[model samples]
Target: MSKQISEITSHEIKVEGKSSVNQKSSVNNDLSVFADGWAIDTAVPLDLKKSADKDYHPVLKAFLAGSFSGTFSTILFQPLDLVKTRLQNPSHHVVAATVNRVQPGMITIFANIVRQEQIAGLWRGMVPSIARCVPGVGLYFSSLHWLKAKLGKTRNQDLGPLEAVMLGVVARTMSGVALIPITVIKTRYESGVYKYNSLGGALKAIYKAEGLRGLSCGLGPTLARDAPFSGLYLMFYTQAKQSVPKEWMQSPSAASVIHFSCGIMAGIAASLATNPADVLKTKMQLYPDKFPNAFSAALYVQQTYGFRGYFKGAVPRMLRRTLMAAMAWTVFEEITRSIGLK
Candidate 1:
């Protein structure tokens, strides 16, 4: 009887020991999971106590989608933009003519241009716009996030308004370098004949008439205009994000409203910032024969048309940009939310 009791006691000890080891293994597994799950979450790093933040990527996804947004928007509103340009530009005839009883809006102007130039005219500058906008959009968002993250790392917190604005300027400047040549293409194509028409025609005309430099017509004006406008856009977007309450970060229309608000501000700021460049871009594109480079064109505009030349088609530009931003951000947020991705 004593031997039987002894055996039972030994068996009980083995069972307890096994249970202890199992519990320890479970704890270790849980720790491993915590490590894997939270390691890459940008918001909450695995080791929040530790000081390592992540670097942002090339942001290709944002660029591709955003370009689609830009392209579609342009297609939808090309006519409006055309009319706006015409109103602002006003050939000697347009100026004297605009003052008369009849004036054309977007639809009418688009139809008129098409009637004269054909359907392809509506898509003028498309190639250059696409080329410039793709890289530009990618660089802008990626830089913005990278800068914002870097700045936020100072406090190990999220982006604040000031940091956001500075980041925007950096991103926009990067995009501007790529945008110059493309701007020339779009300008020439939109300007009409003698200068150029289609993308191919514009390239040849620019090549034969003025050489490669002619393609960089409004680069300086574009930079000057883009910087402040970009700064304002980032500032406004940052401000809008902050305005939303913490709980509403994931909310539907709330994000939309914030984005729209930011878009409105960006549109206004960009319109004001770029009015001069827009006129110069249009004039240089159309009248490349007269002014070859951006500097010469700007000087001519300032000297010939005075300050007013700087802001010829401010109205339509402002409206189109505002619409673009509003639509882009709203769709961006909405799509991300629906897909459980952001």
Candidate 2:
């Protein structure tokens, strides 16, 4: 009787083990697609998987990639940035130069800069621009990746439009606050107002003259411009990508084109929506004493340049911002994809 009971128990155990194996096999067979860099690969060695997981640092990689992209785009678009600064400048010289022309367009101003100060003059604030952008964009991407990871949407996962907006806003706000001082310096450097011989000299001058408040001159309007622009841009870009057929994205070139096009569209929309804030931020930063706060700055612009003052640098800004963002995203995506990050 004891032998019969033992045999029955062993048979039942064997049957359960077999059922579990079959279930696992069925599930594995059904999982043909990978998501979030994870897949059930029974054939892969345990040690290899461990190594892969251990070495993968998505946030760090995102920072590096974003820095590279920002450097490239900033260098390319510095001239446009300089022009935008000049156009937004309500300084006597800039206004006087444009006051006589019937249409003082971007091209005309660009040519004048080249002819007057030489072509290199167009990139007047390149050093500070690169300094601000490289770290700024790196921080933005790293924080974005970190936030997404915390939210359990890391790598190869599709974010909803709202999620994208929230992520963009939060990430950009962090980066903006971290780099506001550099941003003020960069703006002054471009405006041709301050004779900041060196970056250090500029910092000392501003600190000695205006103290902490000077360093944080345009904090409010900068945040207002960046947060909403980033949010709207991400929302629009994500929606555009989602609208494309998945089949189309299978082609690498098609995917690149789709991404760049979406970035441009997103940039345009965001730039237009936030142009007023941008104008106000530039005014506040350039003439902190003249326009002490956002309200006063806004009133000054309205009183001085009329209704169109808010969109002063609209053309160059739209072009530079749109192209730069598109290029940056395209480069960032390529770099991340090559490195096996999503």
lDDT of 2 by residue, 48-68 (tens): 766775687888888999999
Query: Which candidate number maximizes lDDT?
Result: 2
Off by over 4 Å in 2: 1-56, 97-103
Candidate 1: C-alpha lDDT:
0.64
Backbone clashes per model, in order?
A: 1, 0
Q: Relative to the unseen true structure, what is the Cα RMSD of model 2?
A: 7.9
Query: How does each model score on lDDT?
Result: 0.64, 0.88
lDDT of 1 by residue, 1-342 (tens): 999999999999999999999999988877776776754333443564232213313254455455655666656656555566666454453334343634444455556667767987766656666666555655665565556545645322456667666776777887887677776676554555344445677677677777777766666666766766677776777676666677775666666777777677767876777678677667666666686667777898789768876776677778876776667656655653443335
Model 2 — which ten-residue stretch has the worst lDDT? 33-42
**TM-score top scorer:** 2
